[model samples]
Target: MEAANLCAIIAHVDRVSIGKRLAEARDAAGMTQDSVARAVGLERTAIVLLEKGDRNLKVPELVQIAQVLGRPLSYFVETPVPAAVSRRSAPSLAHASTRVLDIEIDQFALDVRALVRLGLLSGAERDARARVPRSHRAAEDAATSFRRRLGLDSQSPVLNLGRVCETAGLYTFAAALGESGPDGACIEVADDSGTVGAAVINGDAGSGRRRMTLAHELGHWLFGDAYDHGASRDSERMISSFAVHFLAPRAGVQKVWSENSNSPIRDRALAVGVEFQLSWSATVGQLMNLALISHAQHDDLKLREPRAGDYLRLGLSWVEELEAPYLSPGFMAACLTGYTEEKLTEARVLGLLRGRLDASQLPQIEARSLEDLRQAFMGHGG
Candidate 1:
């Protein structure tokens, strides 16, 4: 009787711990109790009870909740890891709509943290960062330093920005932030174990714009400007400087400009834009900043933005480079490892892939227990 009572007490303690974790994960996901309850097919009251340790959770129910929360089952069953989030969004998007994306980006970072915990991913490397550039010129210089740091040639275009970012230790992904939301948002989630850095660009934006936004967010992550929220106009300008220079270094721009000196300004802008994978505005703006074009010339060039046909005529591929259903290489690798090792379910793997793949695309494997039956089907008699 005494053992039964002790076991009951331990179970109660476990329930309380799980309840606390549920609440934390819900909060991290930016989900309301009512919303979560609806997704979990439970009453709001039930969710409240679950989060308050006033109710016991069935395994199936918990699994459903975990899926709804975009969390791994281990996240709830194991001891909770401590996490602190530092985030920044475009101040222009500091409204209700952006909050939805804020949740999305935060969830991405938390997912990366979960992968780190599982020894499948590495956390943020604070040691890799240098001091934040203090001025616009400094930011520009830092951009050059960044090129050197990444082993990128000063005159080379970054063909694969997503892969490049992963090389620099920042996980990058795309999210549907809609037309009115911020261009992108970056987050750093710190725990006792380490910090996980992630950036989510607005996939709905134009491909060039998405690439520029990603570079802007990469500036934020590299400089530890996690919580700026674009509050300061000067700070925003500095980051913009970083982004422009990072994407199209001044030396690269000059080289391209000189190479196309005989071309019309529109053609020249298009050439620079295509080569650097920059938007027309960014390309022209960089030209103006370099004093290669007068203010009047900049205005005239900006007015005549190149169309898709123009790029096609130039033999440039008009691929949507930063389109959605995009996952970072590292994140995808971790998901594959987790799934193949039977540590993650097909649903969870699909969820993490975010439409990059589907169920039919997963590896086909007969259960080990059914191997003999599989051999019989293959006509290998035992």
Candidate 2:
């Protein structure tokens, strides 16, 4: 009788510990119980019961939750590595209607945090936000700074922003957003430690749009306020303004922008668009914003929008077709570092990559030597 009683007590304790860990993991991932329940195909009561230690957890349920939270199942059995979230953990999305994307964004940020906590991702070298001054010149100065750091002037086209962002201590990676998903989202891992941590840019967009989104997300990281009920008027303007100047600097635009009425404005927009690898509309809009052209002129340019063939006629290659999905080379390097050091297991590393990346992209992670078993024991014990 005593043995059975002791067994029951032990079971109860384990349940409670698992419950506490689940709650913490969800918090670290910045997801609410409702969001988690919805993601894992459970009722809200199920998540509540699991967290309160009032219900027994199924193995499948625990595994599902681990993947959804972007955590390892082992995390629940052991004391979890604490997540280092910015005091402001909410994401600053360029597209406001992104409730559909909350699950993936939270998971991505928390996963990166886990890797950083494990020392896989090295400490951030610098904070892009610190480089910008808090004045009227904020956007312009930030654009100049990024350009200078990227080894380019306004006259030079940004051939690849994914590589440039890595130089600024930002990890610009891609996450799959289904056809109807937001263009991009960014989460800056801020700690009291002052390391810029990391950021991911959604890359399921067209290649040109992907570059624009990376610059837009940079605006969010540099100057975005925490999740407001709605994007405040001033905040959205600044982000858009920053993206414009950063990706298509005013000086660079003037150098490449043609004002010849005889030459089709669509051709002009396409020319600049091809060079900067940005959306034609956005490129033209920046020109209008700089007062280089009138609003009416922009409208007229839109009328004869250049087709894909038009770009080929000018001997310009289709950049969008040529660019790969925007996964940060730096972040991928860290994952490899952790695996090489045996800090992460083969299954664990591949699992994390498979969850965040597409099948076609899986080969990159697969190519790594995850066979290292040296650090396999690192994850043992709470």
lDDT of each: 0.75, 0.63
Q: Please give the distance, in angstroms, between residue 275's alpha carbon in candidate 1 and its true position after superposition.
A: 0.4
Per-residue lDDT over 1-382 for candidate 2, one digit per residue giving the tens place of the 0 to 100 score = 0122333443445788789778877875779999999999999999999999998887668778987987655455533223322322435433543432444455555556667677766545544234223343677777777678777876777765766666665665576664445666666664443344344445566666667777776766655344343544566666767777888887878777754345666666777787777776777787787787789998887676667798888787665521323456667767767766667666666655644544444333343345443344445532
Top candidate when judged by lDDT against the true structure:
1
Alpha-carbon lDDT of model 1: 0.75
Residue 212 of model 1 has an lDDT of 89
| Model 1 spans with C-alpha error above 4 angstroms | 1-97, 127-129, 227-233, 364-382
Give me candidate 2's TM-score against the actual structure. Answer: 0.69
Q: Clash number for every model?
A: 0, 1
Residue-level lDDT tens digits of model 1 in 128-242: 4454566868988999988998888899988778888877667888887776567877767565566766778888878888888888878777877544333354666788889
TM-score of 1: 0.74
Q: Compute the lDDT for candidate 2.
A: 0.63
Clashing pairs in 1: none
